[model samples]
Target: MLETINRFLQKWMLLIAPSAVILGVTIFSWLSSYSYLVKWVFAFISFVSCLGLNIRSIRKAVMRPFPIIVCLVLLQLIMPSLAYGIANVFFANDPYIIMGFVLAYIIPTGVVSLMWVSTYNGNRALTLTIVLINTLLSPLLVPYLLHFFIGTQVSMDTYGLMIGLFWMIVAPSILGVLVTRFLKEKINKTASFLSPFSKFALIFVILVNGAVVAPYFRSFDGTVILIAVLVFIIACIGFIMGFFTARIFKWEKGVVLSIMYNTGMRNNGAGAALAVAFFPPSAAFPIVTAILFQQFLASIFGRLANYYFHVMRRRIDRRQNGLTGI
Candidate 1:
């Protein structure tokens, strides 16, 4: 019965997710009073989500380093550059928006991205490897990326950022791996039972965090709409670039899916938190606004990729049949 219900939830997860966020915002905006608690929830979500990974997958990714290198290049270098370029063009006068834009891309990919990768039958090993590696490196990388792109215009709490990354990502991941090593069966069972709840945690995060920005949403101006449009375009481009690059490299289907997601989605939650903590409120605008559309875009990209994959398969089948007859 549990398995059946799991399947159902998984099937409609994309639809259910956005709805939950909307519902959460509508019903629990007041819960924003305790938004500080969301960090622990974020940590818990990270732990359980990664609990399923084992040494074998991590080793596999290490053994074959090409995909990891390619993914990292796409994710870290290409996407950040793209975001910076776009921000410079769109908001040349506003350094805060530019900082926000670059920050969104420079942060590590989200932990919840594993859910999407799993939903689309992606390479779990590579996804976990990329997420863990990115998270592990984010402390140094994020600050460097920020300095490189924005120069000394923005002030960063380097120590605070490091602490946040370690606690939110590295610590939870280590605890999760330990649980996997020593209490494998128990952890696995618990993760399975609690897996769906991860989505709720995400929704709650979005809700509470969304409320913080709700005031900004109520009084929108031309600049706000422009930022939203620009973000949407940049995000779509990330997916496209990842998809085409994976095809060029002739990666497996699962790897392709993994690249699509890892390239497209930023750890917006962390980005928002960092922005609010270190930078001005204006710097967090892009990051906060992104939470609304990131998941929605993920769904669209997944379906689009599936459609194209099927089309290519049908073409190959037809060509094979024609050659057989000849």
Candidate 2:
């Protein structure tokens, strides 16, 4: 019974997520009171999110390197370049804003993608592999890319960011994976019970993070709207690029789903966390606004993917029937 409810909630996360963000921003005063708890919320989210990952699945995906390599290129090279260009064009006057824009895209693939992949029946091994590999590499890659792209113009504590990623992401993930490895049966049995709570934690994270930047929303203007639009467009490009990349490689449908979500939806939560921790409060604007639209796109795209797969299955079945009749 509990598992059924959790599955229902996960299926409708699209609606639930955006609603949470909106509610958070509306009651900013109440939410802001708990502002001090944002980091701990993020830490808890990371820990619970990792509990689902299986080391064996990650290893299976890693052994098949082609999709992994393509995802890395899209993640590291293509997405960053696109984001950097967009930031420079629109936010040339403020280096912090540009930093926010860059950080939004440069962070690792999100742990949340695992939820989407599982719901859509995508290759769990491949999704887990990409998420784990990206998470592990983030401690080094995120800072390096920031420094490489923006130079001295955008000041960030590279070492500090690395340390944060290590403790927040790397350590928690390893802990979860190890626990799952040793106690697979027990963990699986308990997962359904705990799933809803983990999701509530995710909403709590969003609400608190929204409250942190809620004051900015009150005095919204043309520039804020423009920045939001730019972020949305750039984010969509990530999804579109992922779609093309999957088609070019002629990947299996499951692999294609993994690619689209991995490419389009980054762990923007990491971007929000980084902005709040290392940069000015205003630097978090792009990352915060991004949370609103990305989830919506994921929801839309997910429905479309379902329709597409259904149509393709029908076509294949018809062809088989025709062959048998002849």
Candidate 3:
């Protein structure tokens, strides 16, 4: 029964995400009261997401660390810098909103990226390793990156934010990895059983965080529309950047797919939690809005990547055949 439910959720995830946002906004008042649950729920999701990971995969993935290093540079430096520039140019007057844009992009890559990578036959070990590294380091990287980009304009609890990430992301991730290491094969069955529940927990987090940014939608105007548009465009650029980077480096198809999803997806739940806990509602706005589109975009891009690789394979085969004939 749980497997059936998990399959259903996976199949309809694109619709489920936007529906959760709409439902959360529609009943913001009731959900807003339970804002305290975000951290705990996020921690649970993080834990569940990490259940498939183990130290061995991570160690193996790091043996050739160039791909991981490239992904880190894209996630931490290049993308956030682009976001900061775009936000300043468009929302120059509102520092909070500009910070929102930066926060939306700077968070660690989502564990959900693994789901997409698995579905597309990407390198699971590489994706898991990147997720583990980024998530573990985020406690430090996120706080410092925020301060570096928008410190002069915004006053944030940098220490508090770091601690929050550790509890909500780093600590739980380590526990999950340990659990996987100990349980071995049994954990796969357990993880499958709990997959549906974890996804439900994710939905709950989105619902509550959506409520925190409910007020923004109530007075939705051109500015809100503009922010959403820019956020979507920037998110698209992330996938493109990763795809081209892997291609330029002449990586395999699996590595290219892994990098694309990792680059494109952010752990918006963590981002929203930090935004609400540390900054104003404006800072959470871009993140909450991102939740509405992340899965949908993932679905679209997954298909595109598949088609691209298929065509490339065909062209390569034809060229090889021609060379043999000559």
Clashes in model 3: which pairs?
Answer: none
- lDDT by residue (222-282, candidate 2, tens digit) is 8888888898899889887886799788898889889988998987766787787788767
Ordered by TM-score, highest first, the candidates read: 3, 2, 1
lDDT of 3 by residue, 172-236 (tens): 99999899988998999989988999999988888888888888888899988998999899989
What are the per-model numbers of colliding residue pairs?
A: 0, 0, 0
Worst 10 residues of 3 by lDDT: 26-35
Pick by TM-score: 2 or 3, better one: 3
- List the global CA lDDT of all models: 0.79, 0.81, 0.90
Tens digits of per-residue lDDT for model 1, 261-317: 999998887677677556765787788777767878898998888888899999999
Candidate 3 lands at a TM-score of 0.97
Displacement of residue 1 (Cα, Å) in model 1 is: 9.0
**Which candidate ranks first by lDDT, i.e. highest?**
3
- C-alpha TM-score for every candidate: 0.90, 0.92, 0.97
Which candidate leads the pack in TM-score?
3
